[model samples]
Target: MKCALVLCSLSFLYSQICHSANIVAFMPSPFYSHQIAFKPLWLALAKRGHKITLIQPNVIVENNENITHIVLNGTYDILDKYNHVHSLVEGQSVMKVLYAALEAVMEGLEYQLTHPGVQELLKGEKKVDLFFTEFLLTFGFSLGRSLNAPMIGVVSMDTTIEGHMSAGNPTHPVMYPDRDMPYPLPLTLKERMLNTLHWLVDRVMNEIFLNLQDRVASKCLGQQIPLNDIIKNVSLVFINANPLFNVVRPLGPKTVNIGGGVHLMEPQPLPTELQDYLDNARNGVIYFSLGSTISSKHLSNTTKEVILKTFSQLPHDILWKFDEEIVSKPKNMKIMRWTPQQDLLRHKNIKLFITQGGLQSVEEAIFNYVPMIVLPFFGDQHNNAEKMVARGFGLTLDHNKLDVRTFRSAILEVINNPKYRERTKESADLVMDQPMSGLEKAVWWTEYVLRHGQTDHFRNTLSDIPWYQFLLLDVILCFLVITVIVAYVSFKLLQLLKCLAYKLYGKLTRKIKTKIN
Candidate 1:
């Protein structure tokens, strides 16, 4: 009996060691928000005894000594460091800058796909059991397939693939729209038409544009490697969003919701100067950051003058994360190249935030219940800001019309108003109510896919149908033609019966007249 027990214990220990899987986390360069958002997740998995390899350029991984940083060799460091493609392209229109950035990322990613460094990483002897990568990379699907491992797409947006827009089950008012699932109840005619338009636009951008980008990127890899096919073959997708703030629906086994994990980032101590300022500001302080991608130095001199002048007028203290040193400083405004954002937001003295409306900043604001005046700088920033505005949690400001008067008014409105604070509190509550941290849920589902097998059902079924056929307009046209034919036949039969009755009645009338004469 003793000998049998020892053997079983040894077997169990071996199994545990085998289960300690290695996860390869691919971090695409050129976007600070993506890197920052992923930091917590990488750390969490490392702490849990999973080996993680972070792929990026100019990335620093400390504290979690267990995690390995695998910097990919690529020449797109210009896009990553300068970030001019995004922050300086539009001058004022943030979306234009955003679209340009996406285009640049697509272009740079294509270059990286063909780079010998990236190819070597993929073909390396180190066996990565699982893959965790951002959806923006687009080529991650290909990498995942090349490694013969399960791929989990980490989406910053609320749940839904670009192609799955109309599938969301829309509840009353449709607060948070998911890309897949049927709308809860039947929509009215007008609502249906509007939703159809929304679906069309979203599909074109997400499915068509992105899929095309993937193809182009694959071609850059020197031959034909079907990237879309690889994506279609993936096992799971992890969306970083909350159902409370977002619309929830039934998803297949492969997809999981894990959003709030950003808050789990290991908090670092604030610099003494910042801490002292917060202590001095008895009333409250305003936190302003345009995000890392958009440099403050890139803004036009006119706009900078307006912003600086406006800051001079504000009574509350301001902690501005400006990359370049300001020649002139306001009495109340202090500029730092980097601010401990997560730590500052959690501080009680921080009252309001001024941001570029990136998902990371939005998440931080919601996490801390800080009211915002969102100056959306591109991609999904407008959509996120619009949603925040709709929820009454904050205000959206157009960058084209940015001026001291407009910006000052928007700030004062958010700071003075009670509704924005109230809404922000509600958002905070919803974010914190999650049963598991976003990182935990993401890691769990990733492990689940490895334990089980290919979850083919999670893929979008529409991919099977041709683009034109998937629309189904041809079927609708056929049905209309059949209905018209049936109506015409019924009309012709009625006319023929009426003619026969009239002729018979006329003959009877004539015979009666002759008899009377």
Candidate 2:
């Protein structure tokens, strides 16, 4: 009996420790920057024995046995070829610029959904405990139903309007700017008007987008997906903005702020050539990159000439993430096809980073206590850059107005200013002071969902309510009807009283007249 009990106990312990769930993550974003936020989370889950099937345009080059990757190879090509950044920098209407971006995203999404690999992955019924996807990729809603799993939206930056509405998070237009709103807080009257307009425009655009999405869904998934069903399936959200670094806002327990440098990992040793170059730079080095989506090659020759001329004049050495070789490169500048950005930031000799102000790049800069200059291109980069300037850790420039004089001046300002460096150190401390690492929080929450079969209890009832009801329009209409009825009754009573008074006054006057006669 003792021997049998011992064996049973051992078996129970093993079962408790090794219960791994099958997770499906559909990340259709074409940009490598978008993948940075959640990449560590999946890997952490894989390390914990969960099997993850990833569907994305960008794949993890690093191999893992528990993870399977399905590449939507043509998606990135579609977005890159669209080339909407120039219009954004040229000060196009916010709505028009965003609409163009939406068009690009839709085109990319069509390619992704129709990809033979993705279609193959979404085939038939499968046992999946949890589904991970970008919050804005509403197409993933259908994927969840197809796989029979609950979804958790992963946002690389701030969550979108759809995500906010789906999760019932507070998204007041002026207070909680949409993912597309680039204006800074304490908005001017002009900005408030524009934001209000954009809010209305966003709803209409979303309707158009949904119509497009529904058609795409029918074509590829062989069924139409209801937006209501999609909203209901979003069990949790992991937004990449750490509250400390972001505008202070209220988020329910279900929406996690996993941003505080989620992508940061242990710094790897830089290549010997790169390391030696950075180490020998007595004047410190500036790392410049336009991030993953915007290619440096796309810059106008005039802009490139200006940037190159500025770099040549700077005393500080330059490490540029240039995809193509420069024919007239400066002696002080070294160009790389790709950069180890995180590790480079970690280097002691690194003084400043010149970037397109991507959130991931900004977070890495903050975490490493580096001051930087931002020339925002598009999307959330503008907001991210504005926040950096507000925090006093960075300076921003208009890419459209970029000249050798202005570019060199801004670079020098950020680098020479002691306060920028000081602010970065303080900000880095606050970011690092979180109770747990972002990766740990992400992994724990992911596993928690897997362990709990039903997550509806965590959802807010506001998400399920119709928009009319959500705004209390029904209540308002009822109140208005009641007020009108009461007002009519009161008016009729006053008229009746007036008639009675007039009759009594006439009768009294006639009685007095007869007595006098």
Alpha carbon lDDT of each predicted model = 0.69, 0.80
List the pairs of residues colliding in candidate 1: 164-179, 167-180, 167-181, 168-180, 170-183
| Local distance difference test, candidate 1 | 0.69
Error of 2 at 340 (Å): 0.4
TM-score computed on alpha carbons, candidate 2: 0.89
- Per-prediction TM-score to the true structure, in the order listed: 0.83, 0.89
What candidate 1 gets wrong by more than 4 Å, as runs, is: 1-18, 57-60, 63-65, 72-103, 159-194, 205-207, 217-225, 261-263, 457-478, 502-517
Q: Could you tell me how far off, in angstroms, the CA of residue 244 lies in candidate 2 after the best superposition?
A: 4.3
Colliding residue pairs in candidate 2: none
Model 2, span 191-249: residue lDDT tens: 88887778767777777877787777777777666755775657788888765445556
Give each prediction's root-mean-square deviation over alpha carbons: 4.6, 3.5
